[model samples]
Target: MIIDWQHHMSPRKVYEGRGGQGGVVIRDGKVTIHLKKEVYQVEKHLEFMAGAGIDACVISSSPISVDQCRMCNEYYHELGSQYPDKFFYLTPCLPLNEGAFDILDQGINEYGYKGVIISPQNAGEMLDSRRLWPFYEKMSAYNLPIFIHVSGHVLGYDAYDADYNLNIAFTREADIALNTLRLILGGVLTAFPDLTFVISHLGGGISSTLERIERYIDVRGEKFWTDCGGTPPFGAPYRENFRRLFDTLYFDMAGFEGGMNAVKCALTTIEPNRILFGTDYPYNFHTDGKDVARYIQDIRGLDLARDEINGMLGGNAATILG
Candidate 1:
């Protein structure tokens, strides 16, 4: 019953006529890949899953344009339908698009998508912006989790304008962490208490920085709101409110090397039930399926009980997705 919650599948058309090098280019310490052929090769993917001992995966696309998002969702829906038990998928939609809610409704009701995937920031609007409230409200009503992932291109900065590895390794996490903090401190969780947000990359370092963030709130609560630019009405008892809101969020263990130290950090800072297993597969393919096993082993080697381990491995995701 092991589930990998953060796998990606790209649409086939992206690599149709690409040159050798298989649509992958490494320039200036950044890896730019158009995995057109590999993403749609379902048989190979299933074989990889079998070798890796993964029972199921939630498939999403590499970030793309708004029209491409619809196309990717259609392809993923077809794939999931063909292998319902082995695959689930998240619907891709840009929150700012006029038809975003329509896409979500059709994807969930008609296509059987399990959730939705969004970037940390889209078109200069952060996830907590008022413009996204309708999408959040729709997802909350359906009780489907929102998957937050980041792409170097979609970020506020120009992707090719800087070194890729440096951005991914360092700057990306900061952006994700900042966006997550905005969601918490901006009162998104308070406003939509039932919404389930599963942020990837271990909350982009949120677990590690929780104490510092809380302390900042303690010392400069007023300035925090002022910096956020709007005095949105979050409930009273600000400190406790912050903690409660944070506790309601969930994180997926994706994008990190399989190591016990990160797991230990997460366990210490976040609730066991709020953590989910995710391999960030295909992206980690250089490990040849070993990373998945290592991640499982790392969690198993922790001081956690069997039930806690089970929850991290699959149970938590099952509960969230259901």
Candidate 2:
């Protein structure tokens, strides 16, 4: 069974309420800045899935405010319930807000959400901030992966500038990579060993940056250890610890155009089983210009063993979601 691990879903009313078209509208080769809610509709979504030969998908919302997280999750839950075989959804919660834990619990236990989606940054707090520990602990206890996606455009840049679009695209991946590295280097992975994190956009260039990161850690390990009170002796090599932490995390091939070099880099840096197929769906049409069928074909065309290909296509996600 083929699964698109990073599909997005937003309520139609949310778009209509804002006096906007509810679906993606491309003009002059540019996607308009609007929530494509029509693609999230049950019938339309299912039709796309069938056309793409996708058996199931894990859905989440387009980035919305903290206040709307619960409502959007509930809406997605209702949609998933109507076609349980083809859909599962992630719970959305503002980790820093009150009642966040309750919302997560309700989504998982009552609504049967497969997992949770948290933006790489909440307000000004990065994912590694202590404020999010309670939510992470709860997710760890539930044994579900945290789906990390980026929200908002590049900060401190002129939105109307010629390079705005390019900057936004670069920033999305950069932020995800930065937050991911923070989570690893900040000792969150070590502290919550049972917690699994599924980073979107093939870990946002992490595979290519692994070497540089290791070198940086090596150069700064002593100061970092001293600053943290050095209670745990820095006996083992830092690289070993980094590898252990990195191995525990998973990455999805979303927002990529089946670039063999990038895929090879990820395979070299991470285990095949830790890689999952993700299309980023409606948005992928804007970024990658390839449909779901072509995405499947691209992965199949890779120089991988049958079992490895199976794992990337769906097996890995099934195991992670379960």
Candidate 3:
């Protein structure tokens, strides 16, 4: 079965109306994401999926407020209920917000959401904050996978303030990679070994920089913690533990417009079982449904075993989502 694990969806009304109202910031008094006319049309998504031979898509939204998050989740629940075969959804959540846990509970117990999407940073709170431990602990106990996606929260540096550089340049990817590392180095991974995390955009190009990251851990040894001012979760050989914990994480092939370069880079550091198929639908593949089919073919064309191809395409997601 083919699954597009990172497909995004939002209600047209909400998308059109929300600008600087919720967490969405109107940069220079200009809205960045112009709402597509067909964004709220589920039938169009189904057509795209059918043309691409896609069996399912896990829908999610990057909402602007707590109320908007709940609204989007309700809409997703309605869609999932209406088209059970074509859709599964992630509960959109903002950690550390009032009624955050209540919203999460509603999605799982009331709406039957399969997983949850968490931003890299929320309200200036990074993923490693101690306040987030209870949230993580609850998710771990529920056995719901966490999807780490960058929800329009860019790097705080002033350098990216112009030209939408955060979205257009490498800054967004860097943010994801940095936060993923934060979760590892900041003791979150060590604290919750059973939790599953699927990062989008191939973990923001992590394969290209993992060697340097691993080497830092290797060279720093114990002093790394001392200099950084954090207690080392495990003993010596931090590099090995880093790899072990990293291997437990999953990555989705999305946001690259079906290009092989990013996939090849990811293959260097990520295993096939740790990869899932995704078409950043309506964002990257909106114009042509054939593009989705072509993307799938590109993965199939890779010089790998049949099992590996099958796993990357959908089998891996099936196993993980189950």
Candidate 4:
């Protein structure tokens, strides 16, 4: 049972009505995303899944306002109800917002959502903010994973040109890496040990830099905090073994568009069981179902054992989602 954990879905009428032909720009043009009919049209999405040999996909939105999250989640819940085998969805909400816990509870208790998707950073607030500890605590108690996907392209660069180039090249990936580290260094992992987090885009290419990040801790020791000009965040203490902490999180194979090089790189630091199959569909070239099938074949062609391959395909995610 292969589960593509990073599939995206939006309501057809809401998406098309927002002036998006093949795509749309929202949030006063602060964000732009390509939206295709395949994103919302259920039959079309199912066809792509079949072509790709995907038994299921855990779906979520590209980017939408918190105000609209409830409605979108309801729509997703309806889809899941209609086709339980083909669709499972992650509900989205901003943790900082008032009544956000209520929103989350309703999504879980009422709508039967599989898990929740949240931005790596919300309105410039990092995931480790104390205000969000309540959110993390609730999620931990619920025993549901938190899916972190980079949103809004909020890289701190000031003068770079070309929005599209910046986002794909340097913006979103960096945010994913930075926030992944923040959740570690900021001590969220230690505080909520039972929490499960699934990071998108292979942790924004984390395999390439995991050692260097870990090396800082090995060389700097406790002084690493003073070097950063601050004490450890109050009430949030991190473990000395950053790699062990990092291993606790899961990564999804997407955004590389089926490149074996990236997959190979990720495997160097990430265990095969910790990797989940993901196709950044309807947005990348993988829109054609054949492309995703090839992507799966390439993973199967890797040197890993059958069990390892099967784990990445879906077994690991089943354990996490359960």
Question: How many pairs collide in each candidate, listed in order?
Answer: 0, 0, 0, 0
Candidate 3, residues 1-322, lDDT tens digits: the string is 8999988888866766664233333544323344454567777888888888899988987776788888888888778768888888899888778987898899988988988898888877778888899889989988989998865756464565655445534666777888888888888899999999999899899899999989988998988888877788777778999899999999999978888999999999999989999987777676447988988898999888999999999999998778
CA lDDT of 94 in candidate 2?
71
TM-score of 1: 0.89
Per-model CA lDDT versus the true structure? 0.76, 0.74, 0.83, 0.80
- TM-score for candidate 3: 0.94
TM-score of 2: 0.87
TM-score of every prediction relative to native? 0.89, 0.87, 0.94, 0.92
Candidate 1's residue-wise lDDT over 72-121, tens digit each?
77787777658878988898878787676677777889988888999888
Model 4, 191: alpha-carbon shift in Å? 0.9
- Candidate 2: residue 91 lDDT (0-100): 86
How would you encode candidate 2's per-residue C-alpha lDDT over 1-322 as one tens digit per residue?
Answer: 8888988776766556445664543323333344565544667666677777788888876444554676776787777667768887898877777766787788889888988998787766887788888888888889988998765543332443452354435656777888888887766887788888999888887888888878876777766567767432323578777887888888998877556677878888889889988877666553223376776887888788989899999999999878
Q: Who is ahead in TM-score, 1 or 3? A: 3
Clashes of 3: 0
lDDT of 4 at 173: 83
Candidate 1 local lDDT, residue 125: 85
- Which segments of model 4 are wrong by more than 4 Å? 24-31, 159-164, 232-240
lDDT per residue for candidate 4 within 88-205, as digits (tens), equals 8788878877766677888899888888989887767887778788889889888999999877556454554454456555667887888898998888987898999999999999
Ranking by TM-score: 3, 4, 1, 2
